[model samples]
Target chain A: MAQKTIAGVNLEVTEDGYLENPSLWTEEIAKEIAKEEGIELTEKHFEVIKFIRENAEAGLTIRKVGKSGIVDIKGFYDLFPGGPLKISTKIAGIKKPASCV
Target chain B: MKKILILGAGTGGTIMANKLRKSLDREEWDITIVDKHKTHYYQPGFLFIPFGIYNKQDVIKPKANFIPAGVNLIYSDIDKVVAEENKVLLEGGKVLNYDFLIVATGTRVDPDETPGLKGELWHKEIFDFYTVEGALALQEYFETWKGGKLVMSIAELPFKCPVAPLEFVFLADEYFTKVGIRDKVDITYVTPLPGAFTKPKATKMLGALLEEKNIKVIPDFYLESVDNKEKKIKSYDGLEIPFDVLTIVPVNKGDDMVERSGMGDDLNFIPTDKHTLRSEKYENIFVLGDASNIPTSKAGSVVHFAAEVLFDNLLCAIKGRELRAKFDGHANCYIETGFGKGSLIDFNYETEPLPGTYPLPGIGPFGLLQNTKMNHYGKVIFRWIYWHMLLKGKELPVENHMSMAGKKKS
Candidate 1:
């Protein structure tokens, strides 16, 4: 496995980019996360993003923000329960942290 | 010149800290918060972690992110709260003095409370996802594992999110299929409750969905112990369930500091008035979130609604006025059924989940009770709001009070 790093979010490629089966949950992915366009991830960054994703899936959208592009962010949500944290990590492109196993 | 000291910066503590920060004047009052860790978890995401839906980064962020600046954020474990003296002693022996107190130290998962649950297979064949390590480890374990009897159990109630185990089973069914092993894995969701959920209406809807997905639901089964050698879960009533991969939502109790300080009840939760969010005995003290003995789901919605009431009530307290703000036990939950859609339910102590459009009457881009892609979209979009809005103590477009504009009495 080749260990790769990006802005503190690490990715360990057992193969090429992403695994064909992804039967792999690596340490790097758990540490830092990958983020999407215009949003970058640092070790200190992901706290709030995961909060919204999980709470939204739980059926309570506690929105008090500007309405413009509010619906546009529908693509930003990961509704598959924990998908927000996973996607935030994915979009952040960071790997797992050291404290965890 | 009164000082308010809050112990533990979890959902209850964070919201209360923010509420008090806005309610009291900087000149007349001082508020200080204490906790050992730095990251704040969107705990509900733990259920999704094992299913590979939420990664570790999804559920976590620096604890400092949520605490509004200017309010003192003490990064240390509380040695004990001297309730009689109105002072908090930290692990480092630093002392925090308070004229008023709010005990929001949240719950802890006790795997040791369950016999053999924390033994040999703790993170191997058996795991608990209440924490980051447990959830991530299980997610990794699920990756290479073949399925047999995937038994998910909830040892007791007053757990953080009451609906999480059910959500886990539902998502697992969906996950196995997406991984091309749905037929190979047999999942049995084991619950301590007589119903699949707290409310009857939501239970009926949720239970039926469980059955519709070909997953079995065993209700009212008391968990006495787990037999690691036999790979079976033995209930107090003598029912035995076999499993290959076991996920346990361990016994959740309040932070030990609460018990050590003589501030909490038997389960370590602070005793407080259910509606007003006021500590029953102490006039200056208040409690909120999972830390309080409020009869509601410990999910984030309770905190959100409580924040609305509590922010006002705290102001009333500082002015030496009666706490008029009342929490109606309002809790709303989004139930994800997977496959690009989900169901939305909004209700409180008096209301059950009814079919209606939410935040808007019949016009929502999101639907309630019934599953919709729009509802799914609503669930997905909330992540942005959480980061940019909620923790900042800003007002959301949705009313602080649960709205009847979109919800029906039922």
Candidate 2:
């Protein structure tokens, strides 16, 4: 774990740059993280992010987000570009999805 | 008499029946186990079938053989569990009431979930080794395959026996090499995950091994559909890879009975308390094995370990005590790297697989995260252990919870 400053607040983060404490999340923090990933946070992005933050504990998956009624999987891929689940969870101020390794 | 109903007499439910029967008084309790199928498959051996290392007979036995005498075994299709009514409706209108319910209805591979996957070429050019039929079909196909673009693709995430796909390619490489068609076969592994595996360290190790075997890996390719006309698989993002023969781990979902009961997630896997193995919505209903939406590999090793935790917790619940045992999401897997060599990994919820020894520190007969002949033997001998020790709920040397004794933090 390493400490990094995001949105003028020092926070602990994992090696993958996921927030160590999701409770420290704010709308401003999400914007800063999105900017780091070279993505512009739009209202549609925020809708997916909000859904991700709320359901983070239930285990986040691209399939789950696709079925979230807010967006389809293709639209989600359009939102987060490279790896939708990985990027969206980072912007949502949550840990990366832990599938069985 | 009070009843304890266990559904799906596979590895998990069978073990639970044996364990609970020994602990609970037979005079006071009536234990019944039910499943539609009569044969209990040693699923781990299904991986060996395609390679001709084992056959259908080696992997299967009568479900009644492992079932204990005191427990009632019913071979009937399950209709649904009326959770609120504390009763289960069986096919042909039989009702079985339960004081407590244990759900162990494991997952099934649904090739139909993918478009054109079960199309005209199914079981001919395309196959899945997850089922007995699929394994046998693939074995027959491999017998005379001239070998070209043998693509092993995973259709979805969180499928049972996560290591099986990796093992399949490894074995395919060896089988082709031995049969003198190694150069002709263009082997590729396609998965939705970013790498060969989910965890960092294990991915690095396995990825290196795949490269060493001259296997090409196409990562981040989520299967959208299979194109029968073009003989290719298309990803959601419009990437397509042509294949001569496609060995797929199709979309795995929990039994339809779970959906009929109205007690499952989108995948039909019951929402379960990860630690306690109890159903999140129904207090009296507990979930075990692949049927539960737990963040762990859906493997027999997981069911074997989780059974111990569930046994303790269920005993506590029966005594009106707090559920004490917590399942650490422990899963042990032996990765068959082919050529009679294999690798082993031991991991839990919070810990990733570390390289070291297993079951013993500094003096392990089995190496962890390291490929060795001993690990291969461990996997081979596991068949005996599965049939004799594991399913019978006999105590093994390994503990239920994961131990970090021999593991080294990187």
Candidate 3:
């Protein structure tokens, strides 16, 4: 149970640095997290972050996000290089989804 | 009773032992499986240990647990295979005469083949994720270490799980980012191949992924030796890469028994028929997995697909019929890109990895050459399937031969 204070807001995080509470997420928090991940807060990145935050409770994935027309699979990779869904979800302040190993 | 001797009770040998035990007449045909060790390792799971994704207990089980009741599991080191006399000699002078033989003694990481790979700093700064102990050692090393230049390289080609090194670097990126020090750690991938992977299309795709992750790829650099004192790796072409942590996939060679048997190529891999899986020099012996010099990626899936073809050919040979089964070198791998998603690649000897739906034509829960969370799930789920279904010789839905139905051409 680790705590991280991002964008002047305090929130609980896991050892892996994923947000523990989805409700604590704000647009400013997403921008700060994205900046730390070496990604600028562009409209495209915001589109993904918003989509993930909206569907955060249902457990959204890159595939489902791709099918939702927010972005294609390749665009998802372009948005988040190493891991699109995981990074996006983290920036959106959602709990880390399981089955990622 | 006629004995069917199977060497090495690993994945392929265990499957053959279980499959043949049911197929052959139990009263007349006797099956004997031999290995030096009692524990059977789920070798694919070794990739996840360094990142704390899988523990040792999850990947290991007793060899006798999976072997069928009818098969005799002998724990002994092999001395040599006297192929001419159809006999296998154990180290303590136990001779086994067999009507048929299956060589599944898989390849092992030979760090000694390199000049300075096993010197001082072995397992400290230099680590290989191939063996169980090495993977565990790396787990400890990765923890409590701050950030620096982290390098992952392959000492040579023909290594087991050809995609593992790539997966390792990708996982490193995700792991470092998760630990909040990805910015401090610089990751570089050094390989002897011209691209990120062996196949052309896969190279283009995976190479791009590496570039996207900001992981530098030093391709076409043949490893000459390790400079242990200087903490650097020197390539034969006069190139050198220095790193604070070097995770290397060492030069893989077949069993020492293969070398002693005088039936293997220069690297001690048995020269096997590409299509039939039969031993090139012996009529009654067949080679599978990493033990065979079959110009294919020596991954577990290749062995699983080859087992289907090999078992049919073995049955035909036993009945004195023409061997109709031909292995098309069908190999599939689930590449973990970390962060909960992965990509799947399905290709044979001829076709390169293409973008398409997999296991279905128009519809797929999994995508080929497309990174998705489902592919990650597929990779994780495979561990369960491998132990319960694959090793027990149960039939899976996937075809033995590579299919072009769902794939897009280039």
For lDDT, the strongest prediction is 2
Residue-wise C-alpha lDDT for candidate 2, range A9-76, written one tens digit per residue? 99999998999999999999999999999999999999999999999888877878889999988888
TM-score, candidate 3, first chain = 0.90
* DockQ top scorer: 2
lDDT of 3 by residue, B170-232 (tens): 999999999999999999999866678866677888998999999999876667689988999
Question: Residue B230, candidate 3: how far off, in angstroms?
Answer: 0.8
True contacts kept of each: 0.00, 0.53, 0.00
DockQ of each: 0.01, 0.65, 0.01
**Segments of candidate 2 deviating more than 4 angstroms:** none
DockQ of 1: 0.01
Candidate 2 clashes between residue pairs 3 or more apart in a chain or in different chains:
none
Output the lDDT of residue A99, model 1. 10
lDDT of 1 by residue, B1-410 (tens): 67988877777678777767876788988888888988887776777788777788887898898898669998998889776777788987888888777777777798887788887998999988888899899989989987788998988666877766776787888899999999999989898666677566677888888899998988756566889899998765467899998999887788888888887765677777878888887787778677886777777778878877777787788789989988887877777777767888887665667778887897866787777888767766777676667766677777666677775557
lDDT for each of the candidates?
0.71, 0.93, 0.87
Can you list the residue pairs that collide in candidate 3?
A: A100-B340
Instruction: Give the residue spans of candidate 3 off by over 4 A.
Output: A1-101
In angstroms, the error of model 2 at B306 is: 0.8
